[model samples]
Target: MNQEFYHELGHVVLHIGNQRQMTDSFRRYKESKANHFMYHACVPTFMI
Candidate 1:
């Protein structure tokens, strides 16, 4: 649940507008970035 929250938060923080008009590739890129963010947010470098 906490990871999910950070994933969405990554979207809100990194993306600032509607995503309905984005291209498929760009959407995938954004999702990838969010996933990266979620991973880092959930597990900081110091904890690794």
Candidate 2:
């Protein structure tokens, strides 16, 4: 319903009137490796 979603969908669908999916998409994989890898990568702390 949003423009950004439609824009991204268009890129994935080749402007076709159907939805398309990406393969080997690690980013979307639940329990994705990025979670494990990026965990604790960023945090705010006060130190002298």
Instruction: Provide the TM-score for each candidate, comma-separated.
Output: 0.84, 0.28
What is candidate 1's lDDT per residue for 1-48, written digit by digit as tens?
Answer: 988999999999998666898898999999999999999899867888
| Tens digit of per-residue lDDT, candidate 2, span 1-48 | 344454454344433322235445532442243343333333334521
The candidate maximizing lDDT is 1
Clashing pairs in 2: none
lDDT of each: 0.90, 0.38
Native-vs-model 1 lDDT? 0.90
Give the range where candidate 1 is weakest over 10 consecutive residues by summed lDDT.
15-24
Query: RMSD of candidate 2 to the true fold?
Result: 10.7
